[model samples]
Target: MTAAVRDIWRHPIKAHGRERLAQVDLTVGAALPWDRVWAVAHEAARFDDAAPAWAHCRNFTRAAGSPSLMAIEAEVDEASGRIRLTHPDRPEISIDPADPADAARFIAWAGPITNPDRPQPARLVRAPDQAMTDTDFPSISLINLATHAAVAAEVGQELSPLRWRGNLLLEGLAPWAEMDWPGKRLQIGSAELEVVEPIVRCMATTANPVTGERDADTLGALKRGWGHQICGVYAVVTQAGTIRAGDPIEVRP
Candidate 1:
């Protein structure tokens, strides 16, 4: 099926906020630039910044664990190496994540929004080379709008693509077609990406992006409708190039 780029998003801080983008440069064998570059480790987390590496999602303060985090929005100032964060209930704040004092400020601001019953946020951790993506390897998530519509239909509610927290959004593909694309190659704009695997659904999908409340049974809908808890596909860039919204996308066998 023919498809085209619909939207692009980057989360400079994992599970904290999202930033919309019009265009981005994809490098071969790398995750999206500045995406999930920093993550807030919880008080109980064993994440060591002196020797940073990928840990389970539980180590970080996530929307799945704290629904309020879903409502936050973030913008990154590349020149200053700072992120400006905003939430409906809180004042806008900018913090330079690399600075210890600024990181402490972020922790203070995020403490209340975090689930009190669970581990509290303590500090921010940065990845050594690539961003701290969920997958062990560098990858970008692609969500098909048609598939999202299908899920929304099954759940009987209007769902937002932001709920999936994907990097690239595509349109004009059949529902569930992406589930069978693990070995396929997609040519998007000037870049080529190889489908790596299907992205498994998590509780984070149930949270409303605007309200930061659990309003949908997205995992249940995916299981009942598709017999699996999967929505999007993860792909790794094989050819470095620029990608933009409205760029044509073609899948190759």
Candidate 2:
């Protein structure tokens, strides 16, 4: 098979917004650079900055809990440590997450968009070292286009890859081929990644990225058609190098 990277994406803040990228450098034993570097801690969260660690997704404002979060777009300026957030229902705002005052401003801006029934957003929390990914270990998410096509067919509608929220989108792989990739290694350009595990489908996939509406029964479709709720795979970087869209991907035994 002639698999190649079709797109690349990074989320500077977890479950908030996605940023498209043409190319990115992968480093050994780390999440994507600047990806999920910050997360919004909700009122019920118990994350401690003194000894920061990966906490459950419930501690942060996420798309699964608040579909409205998917409607937002973010632009992060790593040099300035400033993030610009734009939402359809509200005016665009720029805030420096490093500043306590600015973090408070972000919390205020996000309050209404997130679920009011749930705990309110309190502050923005920065990961002490690596980005705050869903998995316990640092990894990148990969999705096969053919697998997405199969899911869309099962749902009887066109689906957006954004709902999957994967870091790398690969084309030319057979449907569900990625399910067998765990324990295998893949080479993209000069970087090598070892597939770690399959990513289970979550309620977040049901939310439309553009409208932020819960329109699709993705989990139901996956269960009914695939007999499982997985759509993507997580891989840990084993060799460090730059990878770009359209780069040829090779699977290694």
Candidate 3:
């Protein structure tokens, strides 16, 4: 059976944090625009000029070992080209990494604090859409919240989609069921996403993006409870547009 649409999440910056929208319009032959459009990458990395790969950065990397990241919030300000990071008592940090000077300032402030051995300095790289990584869309990734909940219930614990790092979270389906929907098609808002591959689990999923901590039992839980830790599906945008929360998703069974 088709399912009800729940919350729609868009991560402006890959692997950092998510932004929620109510609804979006579908564009012609494209996925959501500017969704995961920018990525922060470590220096001295090479990408296949022809073949696209999922490129990630320390910012998007989770700190599950330190769940404190879940408590932080990031607000990206396009006008000033800065990211305002908030962590309760800590002062707000307006980060503008585009400028070499600004990037250096951010590196000096956040580097040792976040990871002392993560190289002495960090430079932010702008990864274009031409570059590809694990994300199946020019602008989208999908996860079934229902499936995640089922896995948690099966394993007897509370879980979060942070383990999967999906671009879109669709609720209202059965647990571990989205895995069976590969090769099927579903409609999100005005967008049509073709379920393609089964997401392979990784250490990134086990690490909390915020704290950079690890949870060894995380992947094991997925393997035991759901045959695999795959919680949602990936889709290449067959169509483009905006997708927001509460949109009725049409699934072709």
Candidate topping lDDT: 1
Question: Can you tell me which runs of candidate 2 are displaced by over 4 Å?
Answer: none
> Scored by CA lDDT, what does every candidate get?
0.91, 0.90, 0.57
After superposition, the stretches of candidate 3 with alpha carbons farther than 4 Å from their true spots are 25-31, 47-72, 78-81, 88-90, 117-121, 131-133, 136-139, 207-216
The global Cα lDDT (0 to 1) of model 1 is 0.91
lDDT digits (tens) for residues 106-177 of candidate 2: 889998899888788888897787778988888899999999999999998999988999999999999999
The sequence of per-residue lDDT tens digits that candidate 3 reaches over residues 133-243 is: 355444346778876776667656666666666666776677666777778887776677777777766555665444545543567778887566665666766766557
By lDDT rank, best first, the candidates go 1, 2, 3
Give the per-residue lDDT of model 1 (tens digit) for 156-237.
Answer: 9899999999999999888878888999999998999999999998899999999888999999999899799998999999
Global fold similarity of model 3 (TM-score): 0.76
- Candidate 2 displacement at residue 17 in angstroms: 0.8
Pairing residues by index, what is the TM-score of model 2? 0.97
